[model samples]
Target: MELIQEVMIMYCTRNVTEDLVWVGGNDRRLSLFEGVYKVPYGVSYNSYLLLDEKTVLLDTVDKAVGGIFFENIEHTLNGRPLDYLIVNHMEPDHCAMIEDLTRRHPETVIVTNAKVAGMIKQFFNFDIDSKLKLVSEGDELSTGKHNLTFIMAPMVHWPEVMVTYDKTDRIPFSADAFGCFGAINGALFADEVDFYRDYFDEARRYYTNIVGKYGAQVQALLKKASAVEISMICPLHGFVWRRDFADYIAAYDKWSRYEPEKQGVVIAYGSIYGNTENAAEILACRLNELGIRTKMFDVSVVPASEIVAATFEYSHVVFASATYNGGIFVKMEDLLHDLAAHNFQNRTVALIENGTWAAMTAKQTAELLGKCKNLNILEQKVTIKSSVKQAQNEDIDALAKTIAGTF
Candidate 1:
């Protein structure tokens, strides 16, 4: 007699929508707050297993976690062989395990768009065309009960990116459009997890860090998504959204639009000495007194990723920096560059410069911000004179008033 592990039957994968499924991937906890870069709260190499008589596996996990992904697929299939493997994005993390999966199931046919086929050959060196079913943007794959419709999502974080929607189930399995790091423990669906406690911030972090540069393209993608009558969003990673899924979609739209979230102030300051720091603190307190919510971020200490993430949360941004060699501080420069690359739109930005002799951070930051369309800069700038003085305190207060009034 052969020993067997406990069998797992899945109605649908945890993080996926209806006919689409989220089979595996996502780390827990680390993606919550900030600490390090390169290694995000761990990452989930999400894959989906779509079962409807003739089974299809959408994407594969990273090679490092291939074994786990196989386990999830096997558990879902219950010994049923995979008939098709759809390649949505060819990023190594999502496609690394494809070779392994194909080796196990030689009969599986690979389906993908033309550009993705080239990527597969470049990375895997396999002649996929012979066994590949090339599909277009509106191609459909029927699996008895579900009809999977493919939509092209160019520059939606990647050039070869695409999404699959199941009309029968009213679910969309977006490749990475709404993905986030951090696992939702055992909870499978979006409604099962605590959105306020877990999913909200991480989703913003993922968007800002990974796909911030493609804000305009995202707006177009959202318009495309609107055409579909979707009730659930099963992204590649994180939990599946089954109930009130529109809320998540709306949130993504707002962030990508670079619209402000309520009336609040974000003070991101980078100070070599304590002078700029003092200015930021004063600004925070002054804003508080005006009955406005204020959040402070030390650019030197805060990860650029977190600062990017926070941009999606607040309406107004107050950038305070000490001048370094007649320019913005290095950290502040990096933050501004990242923000500008994302086409920071709709938000109001205020500047605070601290320099003993040449006050350059304010001018430089303003010039950099000018490149971003629709970014409103406060006319009144708070200049800290090397040291915190009584006069500087008044300037900070006035700056706070401008931010509050803009709201």
Candidate 2:
């Protein structure tokens, strides 16, 4: 006699381990992430469900996809009641569905730190104290067969942020430490996709904008993480790192230490007319002629997030802008503010300013870049009067040489 097999349906859910499943969904329809940066490739909200002795759900999804998330949880649980819900980060993108989850599984205990617990109250009017089980650093929560250790990672982008480490699987549920801003379309693990080709830029943008402000905190977390054995990194966003852990860790180390990942030049210019842009193009050509690689971006066109990422990636950065209202161009000023706010450091920067009369952009740009640490502002400031004249070519060449010498 032949037996019939009962096939189970999974709605965008994948298994991380025999007892652990990925119960997260992607937000491809949302135009902006946090109403600030553009996510052209979309983003993912990663949450894992561990079906151990105690069925545990780690983190919730944004309210936009709350329905799909609940469906995923139901399908994965297969009618089993939820025992615990671990809150890694209190950001609404990860905690918007907390009240909904508690309503669905009233018996499930919400686990998090005291600071995050307070944030939960501020964001929502839920009775957190009634169901909250606060865990401190070095605290452990044992589920039937798996044990998770909490590591406090304060100012890792947030004051209440913390990571959960599963001792049995040696996986760290990093809240936002190793996260990126791209949707996981079919491929869930880093090795499953062409990471460098597909998600490297987005990952850099995510890191530089979201967590770049707290490099010291990240360094401290890395030191603490080195003491433990981490084989797999399952962050709250983007792909899971099941292979090449060292490469990713090293990248994070370099990024947190404000070190450039490559030797190249990034030319960012804000031009009202084509004159300023023309000067920028000329400089880029000169840099290329000298065998120095360059990445050029028009500040008015390209997003500031990309420029910030490029500034972090390259060893040299050139800010070329046309004077507007006797000051630096607004878009260029905004980009510089972002770079300084993100604590951009350890790079050689050159200034190129254009003005018909009263050229004050160079001075203003210098003052802005001066706020940053370890920035080597080149002495040769290329000043374009109305347009790039034949006399300025020598100055541009000198500036190019100064920049190339550093490489």
Candidate 3:
């Protein structure tokens, strides 16, 4: 008889602490996140494994990467049984593997709040009465050397969302609060990567599109967070934060407050042909000439998520659209509606409309923006009939001057 050799391949895992291991995987093949936003760089589903007197698992990966995630968890455990599964957020991406995990680790007790306990039953049809360890705000649980505290952060994009604080390690398992979109390649911590250059835009896009509407809720959460002493942040997605925690917290504070991060202009245009685009281009040129930092995007081409992120980053916004069917162009209309839905406010806005017949884009745009909060809609509405000729130059220049003057 010939003996056959078997090769066992272990999944990728990273150490977050002496005992805590990152048992998560990246979805590089995914084209979209949440079946909506485009994720070209892919997204990470982060789960943590803590080996202690009582082993605990922090969150779980999405079902798409369930096999690899399990492999990572098993490898990190090294045959040790999981004692507790700490669920920080009940979103499907982070909780989809809960049933599989429970089936495998039959003795594991789920530690979460009442709201999440109900959600688990609703999502997985599992009986939450038997193995659930319910926690509340400021509730503490000890797993040998580590003491974990739960903090309720309702409507931080989800009503059942909560963060876990490790008192022994001074680490906060912040759920999706500080998460970004990009996959963690070799670098697992924020200090390991060029975050501002590589991941900042995606982070902003992620927050603005996913959690922008709940600014007040985020503010409340931030207020609670300020009272805690957080040394490291372990979010459910993207890289972990072991250093420069203040900068990330400040960024979140500004975002939750609807305050622009920088002084600049974002000119987004929806043009049927080239007329409206031409007007936008001309205005962009004027702004640039006047020493104002400007960014231009064709609303028809760019995704609304990116535009929303840009609107959040910049202090000023310019909307130029061609009137279509007696209204603003559909692409621009969609962007405006998204901005409003995200609770966009506290910015200076300039309107430009182009039409061959009835020019209703400017009026419709103004009305839509009027519904938002603290928006300074410029009174100098530039109307372009068919195209921008030399006659519209003075109006364009005036609008540009007004926008530049605000800077």
Candidate 4:
């Protein structure tokens, strides 16, 4: 059977290869992904169906697109019974349709690891014990032409996670290792779209905010991947990587190592009456004037997650906050804590604090940043009394030059 050749991002069925078809769907109506990150462009729940001597479904989509997903399966299978249902990761977005899919294809055998088998019992009430086919690291499953080898990838954000390698097509069915946060509305492959322009920010945000803390685990996974000869990467979300994807993989290497992709500055500040913001703006202007790339955000307006992601992108971060009752401003405090929680490390930091009487946010914010690892705080801190004073303006100039010189 031939598949549709039209390229679109809607809930449409398409072919991934001669033996495989994409039976996934996108949700534009979804406002916030996981009730946290704002998805103005929405996100995708990807699933693939393989048709060989015995048919196999790689994974299931989020429950939001259950109707479209099942429709795609019915259309792709064309009445052929599903022989195997592979569970790459047990995350809710990728595993929500398991029970329903099994019920529709009652004879489909689930191929997963031992950990995911226990998770199945917790997520659904079906008789998984009878239909479960457990695999371990380096375990291979033959579906006529394609041989899938499973690699254990525990704590790559989840305890029960793994990725599959197809020997026939040289493709890796990565669970969430290379995925992003945006929907696939046009091109399915990263090489087909302007990936760096459209999806790069979301990809950084997805990794830094969602999977940032698991650098060691991701590093371990990358080491395992190096052992195989991969021609393409089909992750559970975002676009597939067929060609010109070395940069993305290299980025994962850097990100997993908690290394910056670029040497620049990202300034995030909290202000009560705009005094701290004023200080931040001055620093940003001076830094850019000195030929240091700068990105500025106000904690009161921009999302903390975005700021956290920015911190991951650049080598330097400037934390400026107006002192509130002898403490760091509420929003700045939260933003700093968020960065620390995401396992932020190996970056230089500069401080700027504004207070009418007792300027203490520079010290307080430093205390919070101290919770992170390998941070280099600059000795040249800037303090403002309610606003940027005449002498304090000179202090800002010195601090900006020191930050710019680090590059």
lDDT of 2 by residue, 68-101 (tens): 7988999999999999999999898999999999
Arrange candidates by lDDT, descending. Answer: 2, 3, 4, 1
Positional deviation of residue 81's Cα in model 3 after best superposition, in angstroms: 1.2
C-alpha lDDT (0 to 100) for residue 157 of candidate 1: 82
> Candidate 4 has which clashing residue pairs, if any?
9-185
TM-score of each: 0.91, 0.97, 0.98, 0.96
- Report lDDT per candidate: 0.80, 0.92, 0.91, 0.90
Ordered list by TM-score, greatest first: 3, 2, 4, 1
Backbone clashes counted, model 1 = 4
lDDT of 4 by residue, 291-376 (tens): 88999998898988799889889999999988898899898888888888899999999999898999998888887878889999
> Backbone clash tally for model 4?
1
| Candidate 3 residue-wise lDDT, 1-407, digit = tens | 99999969578988999999998989999998998899999999999999999999999989989999998988888888999999989899999999989899988999999999989989986666788999999999999999999989998889999999999999989999999998888689999989988899999999999998899999998888889788899999999999887887898889989999999899999998798889999999998899999989999888899999999999999999998998889999999999999999999999999989889988899998888999999888799999888889889999999988887
Q: Judged by TM-score relative to the true structure, which candidate is superior, 3 or 4?
A: 3
| lDDT tens digits, residue span 1-407, model 1 | 99989865434245354445567755443443324443344666667788787998888876666666777787787788899998888887688887778888888999889888888988886557777999998899998888888999988888988888878888777888888766556676667778857667777888877777888888888998899897777777777677876777888888887776667888999998788998899889989999999888998888777888787788888899999988899999999998887667778889999999877888889988888888888889988769789898888888888888887
Candidate 3 similarity to native, TM-score:
0.98
TM-score of model number 4: 0.96
lDDT for 137 in candidate 3 is 93
Q: Which 10 consecutive positions of candidate 2 have the poorest summed lDDT? A: 7-16
lDDT (Cα) of model 1: 0.80
Decide which is better by TM-score, 2 or 3: 3
